[model samples]
Target: MIAVCQFGGSNCDRDAVLALRHLGFEAERVWHADGLPAEADGVVLPGGFSYGDYLRAGAMAARAPILREVCDAAERGVPVLGICNGAQVGTETGLVPGAFTTNASARFRCEHVHLRVENAETPWTAGFEPGEVLTLPIAHGEGRFEIAEDTLADLDDDRVLFRYCNEAGAVTDAANPNGSVDGVAGLLGEHEHTAVLMPHPERATLPDLGGTDGRTILRGFASEAEG
Candidate 1:
């Protein structure tokens, strides 16, 4: 069973559940306070407005009781996927590093962005071709990725995924929607299991909805969890 964590202010839990179901996985929403379900095979931290975006986007939500459980599970190599605010929580919990701060523009922006797969080896991006152009929606103000140069080097060494320009496959400000250093939009954990991405894959799971680009990303996770 795949575990989908639901927390106060987490608005995308249902969308995540639906996506997982569409991919034919058994997924359950484990409440923020409840310990992670014992039967979970993997976990997901869906996008949302956790804690009313108080104390910084995911700061308060990271301290939730169940997050500790999620952290523990991740240490044991259970896969975790954090999207948008969920990505923020992962950073706060230290399951993933870095923080989301106000966008360079200083306001929320919503639009479709083009992304190139920089690391296709990650479970989530396994089905996507290296350098593939994928269109996905991004809505956030504090999404820039801040990390030390050494840490960025380490991520590259470990194959942590990142988003690059669809045209040149370069990490630059133009391709970076939120001023994230090096155009970092996603991360694959050191173990290469957990992944956090700012773009909304759940929102683009259907072709009729103007996309099927997410099918590979979501399907890759569900397939690996079952295996």
Candidate 2:
């Protein structure tokens, strides 16, 4: 079973469960206070404005009681994927590096954007080849990734899972929707089993939504866990 954590303002909890189910995974929303189920084989921190975005987008949810169990699960090598606001929580809890901050435009951005798969080596991105361009939608006001210049330089290429790019897979400033440093869209955690990103993979999983590129990313959980 996969647990989709539901926080106070987690609007995407059900969407995540539905998306995972559509992909043939057993998943359900687990309220933040209820903690994780013992049978949970994977975890997804779905997108949304947790705690009304108080103090910060994901600050409150990152400190929630259930997060302790989530952290423990990640340490045990359980596949964990954090999207959008969840990405912020991941960074807040130190599950992933860097921070998602205010966009350069200082406005909420909601649109489909192209992403270049920077590394296909990690479990979260193994479905695609490096340099593949995927179309994914990003909706956020604080989705710009911020990291120290030196630290960013030290991250292995494999650690940078995805980067905003043009349809041709070129990383250009005009293609960067959020002005994230180096166009980073997603990153791997301390281990390949964990990952965080600002894009809404669940939203892009259904073909009816006009894109199925995200299915590959979510499929990673099933593939990795079953392996």
lDDT, candidates in the order shown = 0.82, 0.91
Clashes of each: 0, 0
Scored against the true structure, residue 18 in model 1 reaches a CA lDDT of: 87
TM-score of 1: 0.94
Write one digit per residue (lDDT tens) for candidate 2, span 1-227. 89999999899899899988899988989998888998888989989999999998899999998889999999998988899999999999999989999999999999999999999888888899989999999999999999988888887768998999999999999999989999999999989999999999999997789799999988987778656
TM-score of the candidate numbered 2?
Answer: 0.98
- Give, for candidate 1, the lowest lDDT window spanning 10 residues: 157-166
Tens digits of lDDT, candidate 1, 1-227: 98889988898899888888887888888887877988887888989899998988888888998888888888887888889999998888787877778888787878777888877877888888877778888888888888877877776544556574655566567777788887778887656788888888888885576776777888888877777
The candidate 2 region of ten consecutive residues with least summed lDDT is 218-227
lDDT for model 1: 0.82
**Which whole-number lDDT from 0 to 100 does residue 196 have in model 1?**
88
Candidate 1 ranges with C-alpha deviation above 4 Å: 164-170
